[model samples]
Target: MVDFFYSNQLRYRISRHLLYWLSFNLFLAFIWGSTGESYQIHLTVQALLWPARIFVVYGTLYVLIPKFFLKRNLFVFGISYIIWLLLVTIFVQRTVWQYSRSFFFPDWKNYDMFNVTEIMGNVFDLNLAAVFPLVFVFVKFYNAEQKKYLTLEREQYKSELNQLRNQIHPHFLFNTLNNLYSLILKKSDEAEDALIRLSGLMRYMLYEANVPKVPLSKEIEYLRNYIDLEKLRLNASNTIHFTSSMNKDQEIAPFILMPFVENAFKHGISNDKVSTIEISIIANKDLLTMTVYNTKKINANQDNGEKTGVGLVNVQKRLELLYKDNYEMIRNETESHYKMELTLNLI
Candidate 1:
């Protein structure tokens, strides 16, 4: 209960409501006291009655009426408050007469003929006229304040997600560059070709990845470039089987598939003997499927000298955030083979 009331949001609204209610009653009390003796009320009675009247009528109207009805419906709201005022008038007059017979004695209970017309007139003329404008003033400012807070929260989340994505891409690029460095050290002619492929991959990352989504064809091209670069480092005796079937028009988030391909290259391909890597991608309508298989190298030493790094872990987080329950990934292992199959709903 304390958490609810003391929340940043509730505290602000409660503070504003109290100020508006008090200020409105103070102004109304001054005008009501300055009016004719027939309408005059004792200072002590006025103090008690005004607060009770505001709480009973406006409080009920604001709390109950708005619950079952739209807040913008001023007509229904006005009618509900008029009804509240009628009940309050009856109760106030009865209580006064019961307490003091001389209060309205000359004509007694029939002095002010209580009826629908008189109640509605009093509601509009006294209760609502005094409160509605003030309530609207508070409501307008409060809604604007809430909108501002929501906008700030949205921007903050966007910035944080972007920062995480930026960190992931650089981590991936650093690993790829280290692989290319190994090729250069061995005096391989493929270094130039690898550099060219790296340039194209970097262009996609720098340009297309700034947007939230990219054409599926573009991501596929990026995966192909990465595989081609990896191929340069392996010996001529190695075997790699790669196949892809895709929609030329579909789209997905940029850089989404690169980490999976990197994982396959890191774990599957062996540099020791006759080794093979098999990769395939099939995309149709709203569905995408990718499979990667490679033989585990004997005495396999992982790059970055770590069991696992940022790539696969980041992919898992990205999938959870982007696809939620819409994607499925399965990995299988055998004595001579390891494979991963993934299906994603691109729609």
Candidate 2:
């Protein structure tokens, strides 16, 4: 209970609410006694009633609401509140009336309206005062619920993005190891260099790819390392080109752009074809743009194979989840080549 009420920011709101109600009660007392009563009597009545009101309000709000009302025990809450309210009302009348008579009305008889019937007649007035804290508690509870919903929403986004990132790592490792295995079969000296490059790629994946975003410069370096690993399996005649527009400060979602590059290198080559990949990126102001083009060769599996792969599908979902309306991507294909263009806000 102490932890709930005193959560730094929540404590400020609680203190403000307490002050407002106390001041409002003082205002009501002044208006009630405005006809001919002295200011001292108004202040005395307020001072006496303030503690009684506090006891009722906090009891209903902190105790009854959390303990019964929120627990779906409507019957218990209604019964508990009514019983407590009656006790508070009777105690306040006896205590306040006893003190008030001496200064304001010494000639008054205690038997005039002190009976049960007369006291119960003011139930509406008393209940209104007792139940006034419901408004404050309702608003506080609503705001707390909204904050929780937003926190959960943000965490869900992070989880889905990390899932997409994890998918790319294993797919990339599978292809790179394939190239290393081919080199080992041939007993080529280049197998040692390819192993070293694969180690760097795996290290980056373990350390950085799990993050939500990485610097544009770091992503470019990662892209170059990936291409170097791919070169281990390429023929000397295969041409690869990479270019960038020198925007070092911008950041992008990790692994977001890699699937397109991987798709280019994977499906764009055949053992006997002259394969070529051309990649370029440019950042201007707050916008980052990329173009990846690969020459498409005749596929031996095209007669019985599916066209789209999971890497592309995974990245498509990731872009929609992360960027929403802030990003654009387009794929253009022809008989000879496939091209992908993406534009996104850098910040």
**Per-candidate TM-score against the hidden true structure:** 0.60, 0.71
What is candidate 1's lDDT per residue for 1-347, written digit by digit as tens? 54343345967667756866688668767776677555434453454456446656555646645553345666776676556666666665556434444553443555453566754554454465346644664565477678889998778757755765786677668768987999889888878888888988888889877887888888888888888878877887688777889755688877777777777677666667778788898998889998888777764443434445477667777777677798999989776667888899987
Task: Give the top-scoring candidate (lDDT).
Answer: 2
Q: Please estimate how well model 2 matches the true structure, expressed as its whole-model Cα lDDT.
A: 0.78
Off by over 4 Å in 2: 1-21, 33-59, 72-124, 127-132, 208-210, 236-238, 272-274, 297-308, 334-336
lDDT of 2 by residue, 13-49 (tens): 6786777677767767767677676777656655676
Worst 10 residues of 2 by lDDT: 299-308
- Cα error, residue 276 of model 2, in Å, equals 3.6
lDDT for every model?
Answer: 0.70, 0.78
How many times do residue backbones clash in model 2? 0
Off by over 4 Å in 1: 1-51, 55-101, 105-160, 299-309
